[model samples]
Target: MTYQEKKSIVSLISAILIFGSFCLYMYPQYPEGGLGSAETFRYWGSFVLILTVVSIVAHIIISIIFNIVFRMTTKEKEPKFMDELDKLIDLKANRNSFFVFIIGFLLAMSSLIIYQPSQMMFIILIASGFISDVMGSVTKLYHYRRGV
Candidate 1:
Protein backbone atom coordinates (compact mmCIF):
# COMPACT_ATOMS: atom_id res chain seq x y z
CA MET A 1 0.00 0.00 0.00
CA THR A 2 2.84 2.36 0.84
CA TYR A 3 5.74 3.21 -1.43
CA GLN A 4 8.15 1.54 0.93
CA GLU A 5 5.99 -1.54 0.86
CA LYS A 6 5.96 -1.48 -2.91
CA LYS A 7 9.71 -1.15 -2.97
CA SER A 8 10.08 -4.02 -0.59
CA ILE A 9 7.77 -6.16 -2.68
CA VAL A 10 9.65 -5.39 -5.85
CA SER A 11 12.93 -6.17 -4.15
CA LEU A 12 11.54 -9.47 -2.92
CA ILE A 13 10.36 -10.37 -6.39
CA SER A 14 13.78 -9.64 -7.78
CA ALA A 15 15.37 -11.77 -5.11
CA ILE A 16 13.07 -14.65 -5.87
CA LEU A 17 13.90 -14.40 -9.56
CA ILE A 18 17.60 -14.46 -8.78
CA PHE A 19 17.30 -17.39 -6.42
CA GLY A 20 15.27 -19.32 -8.93
CA SER A 21 17.86 -18.71 -11.57
CA PHE A 22 20.56 -19.96 -9.23
CA CYS A 23 18.55 -23.03 -8.37
CA LEU A 24 18.20 -23.67 -12.08
CA TYR A 25 21.92 -23.46 -12.43
CA MET A 26 22.58 -25.67 -9.43
CA TYR A 27 20.08 -28.33 -10.38
CA PRO A 28 21.15 -31.91 -9.71
CA GLN A 29 23.88 -33.09 -12.01
CA TYR A 30 24.96 -36.22 -13.83
CA PRO A 31 27.95 -36.70 -16.12
CA GLU A 32 27.48 -35.94 -19.79
CA GLY A 33 29.01 -37.86 -22.69
CA GLY A 34 31.09 -35.70 -25.07
CA LEU A 35 28.89 -32.60 -24.71
CA GLY A 36 30.89 -31.57 -21.63
CA SER A 37 29.96 -31.77 -17.95
CA ALA A 38 27.82 -29.37 -15.86
CA GLU A 39 24.86 -31.04 -17.51
CA THR A 40 25.31 -30.66 -21.22
CA PHE A 41 26.27 -27.54 -23.15
CA ARG A 42 23.03 -27.78 -25.07
CA TYR A 43 20.86 -27.43 -21.99
CA TRP A 44 22.95 -24.50 -20.87
CA GLY A 45 22.87 -23.08 -24.35
CA SER A 46 19.09 -23.33 -24.56
CA PHE A 47 17.72 -22.05 -21.26
CA VAL A 48 20.50 -20.60 -19.13
CA LEU A 49 22.34 -18.93 -21.97
CA ILE A 50 20.06 -17.89 -24.79
CA LEU A 51 16.77 -17.45 -22.94
CA THR A 52 18.53 -15.54 -20.19
CA VAL A 53 20.07 -13.05 -22.57
CA VAL A 54 16.70 -12.06 -23.93
CA SER A 55 15.04 -11.96 -20.54
CA ILE A 56 17.82 -9.96 -18.90
CA VAL A 57 17.80 -7.40 -21.65
CA ALA A 58 14.05 -7.20 -21.29
CA HIS A 59 14.46 -6.80 -17.57
CA ILE A 60 16.82 -3.88 -18.01
CA ILE A 61 14.51 -2.18 -20.44
CA ILE A 62 11.49 -2.73 -18.22
CA SER A 63 13.30 -1.30 -15.23
CA ILE A 64 14.18 1.76 -17.19
CA ILE A 65 10.63 2.21 -18.32
CA PHE A 66 9.23 1.74 -14.83
CA ASN A 67 11.69 4.26 -13.44
CA ILE A 68 10.85 6.78 -16.08
CA VAL A 69 7.20 6.32 -15.45
CA PHE A 70 7.67 6.71 -11.71
CA ARG A 71 9.45 10.01 -12.19
CA MET A 72 7.10 11.25 -14.81
CA THR A 73 4.21 10.47 -12.55
CA THR A 74 5.49 13.07 -10.10
CA LYS A 75 5.44 15.79 -12.73
CA GLU A 76 1.67 15.48 -12.97
CA LYS A 77 -0.60 17.48 -10.68
CA GLU A 78 -1.97 14.26 -9.23
CA PRO A 79 -0.04 12.37 -6.57
CA LYS A 80 2.14 9.60 -7.91
CA PHE A 81 1.76 5.97 -6.91
CA MET A 82 5.46 5.34 -6.41
CA ASP A 83 7.95 7.13 -4.23
CA GLU A 84 10.84 8.71 -6.09
CA LEU A 85 13.12 7.05 -3.56
CA ASP A 86 12.23 3.66 -4.96
CA LYS A 87 13.15 4.79 -8.44
CA LEU A 88 16.46 6.15 -7.28
CA ILE A 89 17.33 2.93 -5.51
CA ASP A 90 16.31 0.83 -8.46
CA LEU A 91 18.30 2.94 -10.87
CA LYS A 92 21.35 2.89 -8.67
CA ALA A 93 21.14 -0.86 -8.40
CA ASN A 94 20.55 -1.18 -12.12
CA ARG A 95 23.54 0.99 -12.95
CA ASN A 96 25.81 -0.98 -10.68
CA SER A 97 24.31 -4.17 -12.08
CA PHE A 98 25.16 -3.11 -15.62
CA PHE A 99 28.75 -2.52 -14.63
CA VAL A 100 28.79 -5.87 -12.89
CA PHE A 101 28.00 -7.49 -16.21
CA ILE A 102 30.64 -5.41 -17.96
CA ILE A 103 33.30 -6.49 -15.53
CA GLY A 104 32.19 -10.12 -15.71
CA PHE A 105 32.27 -9.97 -19.49
CA LEU A 106 35.75 -8.54 -19.52
CA LEU A 107 36.96 -11.12 -17.05
CA ALA A 108 35.41 -13.85 -19.14
CA MET A 109 37.17 -12.67 -22.25
CA SER A 110 40.47 -12.53 -20.43
CA SER A 111 39.97 -16.00 -19.04
CA LEU A 112 39.03 -17.39 -22.43
CA ILE A 113 42.14 -15.96 -24.02
CA ILE A 114 44.23 -18.11 -21.73
CA TYR A 115 41.94 -21.15 -21.67
CA GLN A 116 38.24 -21.80 -21.29
CA PRO A 117 37.42 -21.93 -17.60
CA SER A 118 35.21 -25.00 -18.16
CA GLN A 119 32.20 -22.81 -17.41
CA MET A 120 30.18 -20.29 -19.29
CA MET A 121 31.43 -16.79 -18.66
CA PHE A 122 28.05 -15.27 -19.36
CA ILE A 123 26.32 -17.18 -16.59
CA ILE A 124 28.84 -16.07 -14.02
CA LEU A 125 28.51 -12.49 -15.14
CA ILE A 126 24.72 -12.60 -15.01
CA ALA A 127 24.67 -14.14 -11.55
CA SER A 128 27.19 -11.66 -10.26
CA GLY A 129 25.26 -8.77 -11.70
CA PHE A 130 22.06 -9.97 -10.07
CA ILE A 131 23.65 -10.40 -6.64
CA SER A 132 25.48 -7.14 -6.83
CA ASP A 133 22.30 -5.35 -7.79
CA VAL A 134 20.44 -6.80 -4.85
CA MET A 135 23.16 -5.78 -2.44
CA GLY A 136 23.42 -2.35 -3.95
CA SER A 137 19.67 -1.87 -3.83
CA VAL A 138 19.47 -2.82 -0.16
CA THR A 139 22.36 -0.56 0.73
CA LYS A 140 20.78 2.32 -1.09
CA LEU A 141 17.50 1.76 0.72
CA TYR A 142 19.29 1.86 4.04
CA HIS A 143 21.16 5.00 3.13
CA TYR A 144 18.01 6.63 1.87
CA ARG A 145 15.98 5.87 4.99
CA ARG A 146 18.84 6.96 7.22
CA GLY A 147 19.24 10.18 5.26
CA VAL A 148 22.95 9.49 4.95
Candidate 2:
Protein backbone atom coordinates (compact mmCIF):
# COMPACT_ATOMS: atom_id res chain seq x y z
CA MET A 1 0.00 0.00 0.00
CA THR A 2 1.02 3.62 -0.55
CA TYR A 3 2.32 5.84 2.18
CA GLN A 4 -0.80 7.99 2.35
CA GLU A 5 -3.00 4.95 2.67
CA LYS A 6 -0.85 3.49 5.40
CA LYS A 7 -0.76 6.79 7.23
CA SER A 8 -4.51 7.11 7.05
CA ILE A 9 -5.02 3.64 8.42
CA VAL A 10 -2.64 4.32 11.28
CA SER A 11 -4.47 7.56 12.04
CA LEU A 12 -7.84 5.84 12.06
CA ILE A 13 -6.68 3.10 14.40
CA SER A 14 -4.84 5.49 16.67
CA ALA A 15 -7.83 7.81 16.93
CA ILE A 16 -10.04 4.93 17.97
CA LEU A 17 -7.58 3.56 20.48
CA ILE A 18 -6.70 6.90 22.02
CA PHE A 19 -10.31 7.95 22.41
CA GLY A 20 -11.40 4.58 23.75
CA SER A 21 -8.62 4.36 26.30
CA PHE A 22 -9.01 7.95 27.38
CA CYS A 23 -12.72 7.49 27.91
CA LEU A 24 -12.11 4.35 29.91
CA TYR A 25 -9.56 6.06 32.07
CA MET A 26 -11.84 9.03 32.71
CA TYR A 27 -15.07 7.13 33.25
CA PRO A 28 -14.51 6.23 36.87
CA GLN A 29 -13.34 9.72 37.67
CA TYR A 30 -16.66 11.26 36.78
CA PRO A 31 -18.09 13.30 39.58
CA GLU A 32 -20.65 11.60 41.75
CA GLY A 33 -22.62 14.81 42.19
CA GLY A 34 -26.03 15.49 40.69
CA LEU A 35 -25.93 15.64 36.91
CA GLY A 36 -26.35 19.41 36.78
CA SER A 37 -24.09 20.16 39.72
CA ALA A 38 -21.15 22.52 39.39
CA GLU A 39 -18.78 19.61 40.04
CA THR A 40 -20.31 17.66 37.20
CA PHE A 41 -19.85 20.57 34.83
CA ARG A 42 -16.28 20.96 35.94
CA TYR A 43 -15.63 17.31 35.31
CA TRP A 44 -17.05 17.44 31.80
CA GLY A 45 -15.24 20.64 31.05
CA SER A 46 -11.93 19.11 32.04
CA PHE A 47 -12.80 16.02 30.12
CA VAL A 48 -13.22 17.91 26.84
CA LEU A 49 -10.22 20.17 27.30
CA ILE A 50 -7.90 17.38 28.32
CA LEU A 51 -9.11 15.12 25.56
CA THR A 52 -8.33 17.83 23.01
CA VAL A 53 -4.80 18.26 24.24
CA VAL A 54 -4.20 14.53 24.57
CA SER A 55 -5.52 13.77 21.10
CA ILE A 56 -3.35 16.41 19.47
CA VAL A 57 -0.20 15.27 21.22
CA ALA A 58 -0.88 11.61 20.55
CA HIS A 59 -1.52 12.18 16.85
CA ILE A 60 1.70 14.14 16.46
CA ILE A 61 3.73 11.46 18.19
CA ILE A 62 2.09 8.71 16.16
CA SER A 63 2.73 10.53 12.91
CA ILE A 64 6.40 11.00 13.71
CA ILE A 65 6.75 7.34 14.68
CA PHE A 66 4.95 6.23 11.54
CA ASN A 67 7.30 8.25 9.36
CA ILE A 68 10.35 6.81 11.09
CA VAL A 69 9.06 3.27 10.71
CA PHE A 70 8.13 3.80 7.10
CA ARG A 71 11.63 5.03 6.30
CA MET A 72 13.29 2.14 8.11
CA THR A 73 11.07 -0.55 6.62
CA THR A 74 10.52 0.70 3.07
CA LYS A 75 13.66 2.78 2.63
CA GLU A 76 11.55 5.47 0.96
CA LYS A 77 11.62 9.06 2.07
CA GLU A 78 8.33 10.64 2.97
CA PRO A 79 6.90 12.90 0.26
CA LYS A 80 8.55 16.29 0.45
CA PHE A 81 5.51 18.23 -0.64
CA MET A 82 1.77 18.06 -1.01
CA ASP A 83 0.77 18.05 -4.64
CA GLU A 84 -2.61 19.13 -6.02
CA LEU A 85 -4.36 15.82 -5.46
CA ASP A 86 -3.03 15.62 -1.95
CA LYS A 87 -4.32 19.11 -1.19
CA LEU A 88 -7.69 18.35 -2.70
CA ILE A 89 -8.08 15.15 -0.74
CA ASP A 90 -7.14 16.95 2.46
CA LEU A 91 -9.64 19.70 1.76
CA LYS A 92 -12.41 17.23 1.15
CA ALA A 93 -11.57 15.39 4.31
CA ASN A 94 -11.64 18.57 6.34
CA ARG A 95 -14.93 19.64 4.86
CA ASN A 96 -16.53 16.34 5.68
CA SER A 97 -15.11 16.37 9.18
CA PHE A 98 -16.35 19.90 9.81
CA PHE A 99 -19.78 18.99 8.51
CA VAL A 100 -20.05 16.08 10.88
CA PHE A 101 -18.94 18.15 13.85
CA ILE A 102 -21.46 20.89 13.09
CA ILE A 103 -24.22 18.34 12.99
CA GLY A 104 -23.08 17.04 16.32
CA PHE A 105 -22.94 20.51 17.74
CA LEU A 106 -26.51 21.14 16.71
CA LEU A 107 -27.62 17.86 18.17
CA ALA A 108 -25.87 18.68 21.40
CA MET A 109 -27.76 21.95 21.52
CA SER A 110 -31.03 20.22 20.78
CA SER A 111 -30.47 17.94 23.70
CA LEU A 112 -30.79 21.03 25.89
CA ILE A 113 -33.90 22.10 24.00
CA ILE A 114 -35.37 18.69 24.76
CA TYR A 115 -34.54 19.04 28.47
CA GLN A 116 -31.85 16.37 28.64
CA PRO A 117 -29.20 16.56 31.31
CA SER A 118 -26.18 18.81 30.63
CA GLN A 119 -24.05 15.70 30.73
CA MET A 120 -25.88 14.37 27.71
CA MET A 121 -24.93 17.45 25.74
CA PHE A 122 -21.30 17.01 26.69
CA ILE A 123 -21.45 13.36 25.73
CA ILE A 124 -22.90 14.13 22.31
CA LEU A 125 -20.28 16.79 21.68
CA ILE A 126 -17.45 14.50 22.68
CA ALA A 127 -18.69 11.61 20.60
CA SER A 128 -19.08 13.89 17.58
CA GLY A 129 -15.51 15.10 17.91
CA PHE A 130 -14.23 11.53 17.99
CA ILE A 131 -16.40 10.52 15.05
CA SER A 132 -15.23 13.51 13.04
CA ASP A 133 -11.62 12.56 13.53
CA VAL A 134 -12.35 9.04 12.37
CA MET A 135 -14.38 10.32 9.44
CA GLY A 136 -11.52 12.54 8.26
CA SER A 137 -9.08 9.63 8.36
CA VAL A 138 -11.52 7.37 6.54
CA THR A 139 -12.12 10.01 3.89
CA LYS A 140 -8.41 10.37 3.26
CA LEU A 141 -7.97 6.61 3.05
CA TYR A 142 -10.88 6.24 0.65
CA HIS A 143 -9.71 9.00 -1.67
CA TYR A 144 -6.19 7.67 -1.76
CA ARG A 145 -7.37 4.15 -2.52
CA ARG A 146 -10.24 4.94 -4.91
CA GLY A 147 -8.75 7.68 -7.06
CA VAL A 148 -10.30 10.81 -5.52
* lDDT values, one for every candidate: 0.59, 0.97
TM-score of each: 0.55, 0.98
How much is 85 displaced in model 2, in angstroms? 0.9
Candidate 2 segments whose C-alpha is farther than 4 A from its true place: none
Give the alpha carbon lDDT tens digit for every residue of 36-79 in model 1. Answer: 55556655555556545655675676556656665677553323
Q: Pick the candidate with the highest lDDT.
A: 2
lDDT of 2: 0.97
| 4-109: candidate 2 lDDT, tens digit per residue | 9999999999999999999999999988888879999999999999999999999999999999999999999999999999999999999999999999999999
Full-model lDDT, candidate 1: 0.59
How much is the lDDT of residue 132 in candidate 1? 65
